[model samples]
Target: MGNKQFSQAQKLTILKHAKQIGPKEAAKVAGVHYTTVYEWKRQLKELGEEAFLEHQPRRSGRGEKEITPEQESAILQVWNDNPAFGPGQVRSQLRRQGTTISIRTIRKVMEANGYTAKQKQNQVSAPERFEASRPLELAQMDILEVTINKVRVYLILLIDDFSRFILGFRLLEQTSVDEVIQLVRRAVDQYGKMEELLTDRGFVFYSWRGINRFEKYLENQGIDHTHARPHHPQTLGKVEALNKRIKNELFGQEHFSTLEQAFSALTKWVEHYNHKRPHQGLGGFLVPAERFHGQEQKALDDIANSRDVTAQIQDIERSIVNLVLAPDGSVTLYLLGQPVVIKGGSHV
Candidate 1:
C-alpha cells in the first residue's frame, strides 16, 4: 500500500518463511516490516490459500477524488449543449443547478475528450503593440472580397492608425491601382496627408521592380509607401481590425438584392461609423471624428478668436530672416532668424 507492493508469490513466500521462523525474522529476511508480515499472516488465516488471489476493487480514487459517471455525463451534457460557454460559465451554470465542479477538472475532461475549451486565456490581456502616437501619422489600406446576390465585388478600405477612422472606402466590381490611389488622395484631402501609407504587397498596391504606378503616385505626392510585413497583417493592425469588424458586424450578416443596395447601405453605415460609433482606443468611447477633429461645429469660430493661431504665425515669422541666392545660384535658407550662405565656384 505504501511504495512497496507484494506480489502473490512474494506474499506466499513471506508467509511460508514466517511460519518457519517468525514474523520479525521473516520481515528482516524479506526486507519488509513485522507489521506487514503480521497483516499478511492474518489475511492468509482469514481466507485460507485463496488469500493471495485477488479481484479488481469496486471503487478507485486513482489518487484523486472520485467523479461519478453521472456527474461526468452532466459535464459533457452541459458542454455539448452550450459549446460556446467557457469553463467558468459552465461551472457556474452547473453550480446553479446544485452540481459543483472545478473549472480545472472540467477543462481537463474537455481536453481529454477532444472537445474545445470552454475557457482559455486569463481575463486580463497584454497591452497593444506598435501603435502610432498622433493622428495622420500612418494610414493603412486593405481590400476585402465579398459576395452579394451571387455576384462578387470588393470593398476597398482605408483607416487611420491612431484614430482608427475609416477615412474612405469604395465598393467596386474589382480593384484597380487608380481607384486605390484616388482613395488615398481623397483621404489626404479630407483628413490631411499622412506620413506613410501602409498596405499589403498586393499587385494593386505594389510591384517589386519599381514600376508600380501607385508607388510612383505616392512618391510624386511626397508620401512614403510601405508594404506590410510579408504575410503579417498585424503590421496594418488598425485597418485589419476595422475590416474584421465590418465583415462580422455588417457585410457578412446582411442580405442584399444587388450591389447597389449594399453600397447604399454601406455609405450610410460609413457615415455613422465615422461620426457616431464609439471606439475603445479613443478612450471615453469617443467617435473617430471627435478624436480626429473634435467639435467641428463652432471650432473654427473659436480658433479665429483664440490667440493660438496668432502665436503660431508670429513664431513662424520670427524663424525666417530671408532666402538668398548666391552668385553660383545656390540658395541659403534659415530658421532662427539667420542666414548662412555658401557659393559654388561657378554657375554653368
Candidate 2:
C-alpha cells in the first residue's frame, strides 16, 4: 500500500486481461507499465478483490491534541454566563482550566457558538446648531405655543444665548406688545440691560409692521438688538433649544389645565436648569448663571472702582438729553437748557 495506486475495477480488469492475454499486450491495452500489471496480478491472486481497497495511514504528529467538543461547549457556556468576557479572556480562562487554545482560535469558536458580532444602535439626538462665544454677549427670546383649557397661550421666553440663562419668562393669553414689553422690562430690571438681545422675526418681535417696540426700547437704552432671519427659527438657537427641552424633558407628560400649574412647573424647571443641570458648553460643566455673571460681576466691580464715576454720570445725562431741542432751536441740548415751545408742544 506504499504508493501502489490503482482503482479497484481497474485492478480487477487488469488482472483478468493479464490472465487472458500476454502481460506485455495487457499492459499496453491498460495504458500502464508492465511492472504495474504484474503487481496487480500478484495482489489479485494473493488477496483477491480486497487487495484493490485502501486504508488510511496512522498520524505521527501530536495527533488530535486540539480541544474537544465538550471543551468548546464549556467556553461558550462561560461566555454566556459572563457576557463581559471577550474571546481573549475566555481563552485565558480556558488555559487556566488546562485547555490550551490560541486567542484567534477562541475567537473563531466564539463566533461559531452564537457570539456573532453586531453593531451598536445609535439613537441619541444631535445637539443644537448654534453656539455662543461669550457669556451675556447675546440672548435669545422665543414665544412657545401651547394650549390651556383648550385655549391657546404663548409662553414668552427670554434666554441668554451665551450662557443659556433664562433671564425672564411669562405666559400670556395674547401675543400683545404690552406683554412682550413687560417681559423685556422685567429682564432688564432684574439683571441690568444686556448688550444684545437676539430674537426671531416673529410678529411680536417685528411688531407686524417692522416697528419693533423691543428694538426701539433697546435702542433708546443704547442696547444692541438683533432679530433672527425669516423662517429660520434655529438662528435664535438657545431659546429654541431650551423650549424643546422644557417641552420634552419637563412638561412632556404633565397635563396642566391652568396657567398657574404651568407657571409652577416652569419655575421648578428653570431652577433646575440654572443651578442643578450641568451645561456642556460651559467650562467644567458649570451652570449658566454661575458662568454668566459669577466672575464677571467681580471683574466689573473692580473696573467700576477705577472708572471715573462723575464723568460716567455726566456722559449718561448728556446721552439722555441728546435728542432734546434748545430754546434757540438747537439740535444738541442738555437737561439744563430752558424748556421751549415747538409747534404748540413743550420741549425740555
Candidate 3:
C-alpha cells in the first residue's frame, strides 16, 4: 500500500528500455529491481503515463449491472426526503415500494448519485473508551441541551451501555444535584439496580456533596461508581448518540413553549423510541428494546404479570398517603410531609 516516488522521465526511460531489452539487464542498467522494471514496462505499454500517477484498475471479478437514470433519481428523492433512512432501510423500503433492487445496488446508486450517508460528527477529536460486557452491567448518564420558551432546559438521560437502550429520561429546569439523584433513584427503583454507574465529571456529578452521597449509597448497595475523564465527553458515546437521535426525532425543527410541553412530548417520543424505532447500530435495523430485552414468546398470563408490575408505577400520588406494607402484611402510616426512609417496600 506504500508508494515509491519516481521522476516522470526516469519512469518513461525505464519503461522504454525494459520493453526493448530483458528485465534483468534493463534493471541492472537502470539500477532498480527487475520486478519493478517489468511492472513499469507493462504499465506503460498498457496504460501509458497515467498509470504512473494514478492507481491501476482493481480486479472486481464481475462488473455491476447498469441502473437507469430514473432509478437513480428515485433513490435520490427517497434519500433526500428521509434524511435518517440509510441504504439498507431505503433498499428494503424500495423493494416494498415495488423496486426489484438489492441493497448493494442501492448503495452503488447512492454513491453515484451523490447521496452520501449523514454522519453524526462530534466537534471533539479524541477517542474515549467505556465497555460494559453484560446487559444492565453499567449505565452512562448525561445531560443534553434543549430550548423551551427561549430558556434552555437540560435533558437528563440514562442509557444502558451494553443494550444501547435509553433507560430513562427527564426534562429538568436545571442540572441540579437533587434532580439527577432523584432521577437516578427512580431509574434504579424501576429497572432493578445497575452494577455500576458511569458519568462525566460535570458540576452535578463531581460535586463533593452529591458525589459523597452517591458513593456512600452505591457502596452500601455494593455497586461500583466511576467518573469519566474531565473534558473528554466522548467517554460516554452511547449516551451522547442517544441524546442526538432523541433531540432530532422528538424536538427537531420545532420550538417548545414550555418545559411541561417539552417533557410531555419527550415522554411520548421516548416510548416510541424504545418500542418502535429501528436502530442502525443493532444489525438488520432491529428495535433496541427488542434486542435488549429478548423478543421471547410471552403467554397471556405473562402479559398479565407485566401489566401488574406496570400498574405499580401508575398509582395516583394524589390519592395516596405515606403508608408502608409490613412483612407480615400489615399497613402503617407515617406522618405526612415527614422525610422517613421506607425500606424495600412500596409507599402509597
Candidate 4:
C-alpha cells in the first residue's frame, strides 16, 4: 500500500479498532502496516493525541523551512567567522552563544547559502582510541612536512594526549634531532614534565641501531619514550588529525611567501584551536584549554546549570593588589593604596 497521511481523528479511530481487534487485524482492515499501527499506539501512549497534531507529513523540495531570518543571519555569520566549521560545529557555536538551533536547520541554511559541499564518508572501522587519565600524563609528538613558497619545511608538534592540547609547536627548516629535543624541552618547561612521551618510529625519535639524542634526553628527564607500531599512522591518531586540520584550515586557505608569515599564521590558528574553537572530541562544547587547566568539571557544571561560561574579565584598567572581605560581608579592593568598595549583596 502507498504511504498515507492520517488525521488525528482517523488515527484515534484506528487505535480504537486496534484495541478491539489486535494491531495486525486492525492494520489489515485499515490497509496500513502492522508496525505503523504499533508506532501510532506508542506515540499516543507516550505523548497523547496532541503529538499527532504536531507531526508534519513529509513533502517534496526541502519541505517547509522553519528557521527565522535572524537565525539564518546568525548561521551565516558563524560560517563567515570560521569557514572550516561544518553544520555540527555551527550548532555547537550557536549553542555556546545562547542560541539553541538544530543541526538540520543549520545544514539547511548552509546548503541554501552554497557553503556546504558533498563529503565522502569514511567506511573503514576506526581503531580503538585511548587517552591518558589526566593532563601531563602522556604527550604525543609528531612532525608534518609541508612546502611553503617552494621551500621544504617541517612542522613539529607536541600535544597533550589527555586534553589534545598543543603544548608546543615549531616550524623548522629541517627535522633535526636537536630541534625535536628543544621542542620537548620547551613543552616540559612550560607545562611540567610528562610521565610518558609517544611518537612514531622516526629517525629523530627512535634509533634503529642505537639510542638517538632525543631518546637520551627523554631518559634524562625521567620520561618513558614510547614508539608507535611501524607503518601504523593510526597509533598517533590525535596528532595526525591535528596535522590534517592544520593543512586544511590554515595552509589550504592562505598562501604564504615566507616561513615567518606561515609561522605567525600557525600560532594564531593554534591559539584559536585551543581557546576558541569547540573540539568535537571534548563533547563539542569544552575547549582544550579548559581541560588542560583542570576547569573541565566547572565548565561542564556551568553549562549544565544554563549559566554563561564564557563570561570573563578580559581587561582591567587598574592592577589589583589585594581583595579584602569585611566582617559584614562586603568586599574591598586595595589598588595602589587606593580602596574601592564592591557591594557583596546580589543584584537583581
Candidate 4 wrongly placed segments (more than 4 Å) = 1-65, 311-348
CA-lDDT, candidates in order: 0.66, 0.61, 0.62, 0.78
- Residues 47-122 of candidate 1 have per-residue lDDT tens digits of 7776445622233233223344566687888777545445665564455344667776676556545555334657
Order by lDDT, highest first: 4, 1, 3, 2
**Which structure is stronger by TM-score: 1 or 4?**
4
Model 3: per-residue Cα lDDT at residue 321 = 29
1 against 3, candidate with superior lDDT: 1
lDDT of 4: 0.78
**The best candidate in terms of lDDT:** 4
**Prediction 3 global C-alpha lDDT:** 0.62
lDDT minimum window of 10 residues, candidate 3:
311-320
Model 2 lDDT per residue over 1-348, tens place: 122344567567777887788775886676654545554555566675664445222342322234455766877775774454567656544543445556655665665444645567796665457665444456778898877668788888987776687888887778876788788788767665666778777776776665677668778976677877788676776677778777765556578888888889888778756653445555422445554553324323433344312112112211112243436775532221122346756443
Query: Which pairs in model 4 have colliding backbones?
Result: none
**Model 3 superposed RMSD (Cα):** 15.7
Q: In model 3, which residue pairs have backbone atoms overlapping below 3 Å?
A: none
Model 2 scores what on Cα lDDT?
0.61
